[model samples]
Target: MMKSKSKILVLDDDPNIVEVIVTRLESMDFNVHGFTDPGKALDALRKDSYCVLVTDQKMPEMDGMVVLREAKKIDPDVEVIILTAYGSIEGAVRAIKEGAYDYISKPFEPLELVTKIEKAIEKRELKQRVRFLEQEVGDSIEYRIYAESPAMKRTLAIARQVSDSDSTVLIQGESGTGKELIARMIHYESRRKRRKFVVMDCGATPPSLIESELFGYVRGAFTGAIKDKRGIIEEADMGTLFLDEIGNISPEMQTRLLRVLESGEFRRVGELKPKQVDIRVLAATNADLEAKVEDGSFRPDLYYRLKVISIKLPSLRERKEDIPGLVQIFLSEFSRKTGKKIMGIDKRAMNMLFNHQWPGNVRELKNIIESAVVLCKGTTIGPDEILLSGIREQKEENLNTLESQEKNLVIQALKKANWVQKDAAAILGISRRVINYKIKKYNIRPEKVN
Candidate 1:
């Protein structure tokens, strides 16, 4: 798909420089609007929303830094990148501290400028998404697992179809993919809807206490068992038990849980008699249980038993098309809670959101939007309102090609160094830290490099 281009606001007093940048960026598929006058560019800033604002450091009436500051007042979320000459490095750093996304040194490479611009746009979009989610999902009673993409629609359909069943279901996806919400939906829509639905995070509990907590104990069973207690399983007898982060369970806990699944019975501590319950099991994990099984961290039998039916939630990056809708919903939500009358997002901000690789998924998106809404002073959110400068640090791409540069570099290094970390780092003239980071970031296989 030809991804939608982010809008670029180019401000420079020199018509020639403005013309060159506009043609170059537009040729790269960006939507570019330029102004040779700082005042005119500020007018454009007030009238239109831009994903990125590129301005010259030294202008006739007003400097680029001054223009950028004013541009932020008009639209806080708009990303600003300054173009600085040789001696203006200090000024560029000051601009960065004042909220500019990046600075391009004069006489820079076309490729380098393009990479920085791409990163700036990506960072801006991430901020906008975070703002939208925070604003929309925080206060709504009709909370939905929002997904308009085909892949997400399919997953939602599967979730709905299996929600009413008594069978155990395993939800697999990366963290922030809304596994808990899916589990809640299943319980809410099931035959046991009116009964209590208890959640137990296997990953949170200490291994020593997981057994006593899940299958309670009699009075004086242990040091803290001064009174008789109802276990989580008993507490949720006619309801549903949500086992979150299921892959983190220890082998011993897995065995105990396995027995419960098989017999629907568990005995309290210090009691010989077994108690029977009719609770349904719904488990979720971001880990690959199958891979864990291969490595013996998880039991194969337990994995099979829990995964009678599995639903995998797609990552946020895999469903970029749904971002626009998600953003709107979040805006309304945050505006209500924060008492901010924020009305809408700038078109350019929305474009940036659709291009970001959201490593943190929906949860991260919600946090970003909430932060922006809290910090915003107007009815509309602009690019600078979102804090996404660090997002680019984690991106695997060259910020331009998404694939070419890093992939090729890793492959070449692996070939020359026989895939050894120290050797590869030496071949690339970078630290082992950088090499290791790249290897993981690109999911590169040294074994396959040759």
Candidate 2:
């Protein structure tokens, strides 16, 4: 298709050359568009994205130099390769000066041209990856390292210790407790750090879509499957796959995933042939898999297979000692993000944050700080800038009101369920997702009730 990432635009005045090049690249799994006219090739460049431009130096309309310049304007990232006459140093040098990636001499081996195109693709990807990593660092490196509390220190220690192992790890915690962060820490510290660390939020993804997303599908796997597709598992073949909300998946889906864990081989959707992968799996869930297994909603065998090692993250309220450190880190982080010179939080705001129930945990704290930084007119954030239906407002409201009653009801159910969200949801006749949302909404916890 025109929008495919691996598409190549091949332009040669000679129809035979275009045909040969297109056939070769197509055989190697590239989506290629061949054009004999310089005008038509330029039009195609405007129409779709292409990874490389392979163009002829000698043309009646315009030379490869002109085509290269035009292609660069269309897509600055497009790598260009000029087709030059044998021993034509002038043309090659001109092409390079004009920003062509490389030049291929006429009558060159098809394999040689393929080799250069591969390198051009590699160079382009390297540049894009560096840019992506820069953005990630700017966004998250701020609060990722704060371990001021003993609970947090213990959690991080377990993560670091398991970085050297290849066993499956089950991370248990409440939502917004940075389970993915811990998983990322394990992956980036491991031997496969250079490879991809693929993540899938199993709870957010629908049961109907889970199969094809995890194992991928071969061409003609189903009616709408136009081409072979790589799933999240395939993308993380040599590295790690972090499945969040693992307990939310269906019984049938769990069996399929268990196959991948027990054996490295898995069959893609509608494909008979089994493919193998080498990957360490790390699964996280706020839901209690032990409770689910007891109820027969989650398979016991699959649960055991995934929990070779386990780490439980404490809620923000349990580790309130880290609040100030976390707030300062977030202040600096959001200051950089919003281009604000915010210096600090006032004592009242800091006190409010410290005393808040923090039902949404560290993630809630980060969001509140980001919001405050945006609203902050001066260098310091005051009490009013700390926006929430939190402790500040809770103190000002009546205990007998609907909001108060609802908060008490949630905490009562939570205590009865032993703080397991899935069990608590069952007790309240609500979905686990709903209870999770209500927890964040009302900021409910036992410590806040008294």
Candidate 3:
């Protein structure tokens, strides 16, 4: 039996014609629905999705032209085929002008109609694929970063400086520190921004398949290699390829990657000829490549090549000054996404966020905010809504030490506001009395603070 994923709608005023068309389509393994009334057909089109609309031109309630126009309105990608006993050059032209795929003459061969249906389905599928690609590009085309820290500021400055050049950049960081985010900033800010930005995770993929996945393969290159497939490297031609967890790649894969970096050429598995591609490579990892090299698990030559332009990102704890801004941004993001009205975080909750060491880093912070937003019933996110892993088990005294989150925030805000108690209070949105109390509590002596 023939196979298709297209859900076809067959509409003819005559019951016999509808039955014949539906039966033929179903026998060919097409998911077909039939309707004798134009009203019902249009209703179905409005309520459900149909890739192909087969409608009789002559109808009592509505003409096929009307159906064609309405179907297009419902789904511009829907391909309509007009069927009429009174087929004419004028009628066919009218149908085409009204957005019909094709006009069919009465008593036409079932095979001929089926062929047109198949062609229409192919066009519909092609349109969908194009739309998906366009959406992908549209969604992530911009590489703007709203970061709020000097640590990130320095990182981005380096990233922007290297974007114009085609040199390979190796970004070093603990996991969840937004290494990939920095890579995309470089890509979007570069000349090759119009092309694709393909991502491959070396740590997640098995070594046996990494070769085939990175370099692609021909049909029958191995078992289940049913068709020739272009690898990730080919897909990223004239674009950017970001290999995450680069240290996890096998030694054999490292040799192949080095060749690509040096020569700009690679061969698909089972293929004799090599395909030349121009691509800028960006690699990231939480592991230390130097240690790996020392242990002889990684290639030293490849390591040097990848480290041509190096960037080391700080862990979240090192950039604690950014927590307030990051938390507020994450709160707004998760609030909008979840349709929650949580507009702000309570001081204790914000303090809890600051207290955590954040082993998972910014990603963990974002997830925590998302969870808080989902669970928060009131407009503000309280400490009860904030579920921290280590806070509950840790003692209250440790949480409220002289070097605590609250004291640090007061100091930073004081420094930012030029040591004026009232201004610092304004910065932290607290009263002057509160700021003075905090200053005394944290032992803020002017000479020592300065």
Best by TM-score: 2
Candidate 2: where are CA atoms >4 Å away? 1-143, 387-450
Report lDDT per candidate.
0.77, 0.81, 0.81
For 288-391, candidate 3 gives per-residue lDDT tens digits of 89999999999999999999999999878888888888878877777777888877999988888787766557766765676678778899988887752112
Q: Which 10-residue span in candidate 1 carries the lowest summed lDDT?
A: 387-396
For candidate 2, give the lDDT of residue 116. 91
The alpha-carbon lDDT assigned to residue 203 of candidate 1 equals 63
lDDT (tens digit, per residue) of candidate 1 on 69-130: 89898789889989999987999999999999989998777778778888887787668656
Could you tell which candidate, 2 or 3, scores higher by TM-score?
Answer: 2
**lDDT, model 1, position 63:** 84
lDDT of 3: 0.81
TM per model? Answer: 0.57, 0.65, 0.59
True-structure lDDT of candidate 2: 0.81
> C-alpha displacement of 408 in model 1, angstroms?
22
lDDT ranking, high to low? 2, 3, 1
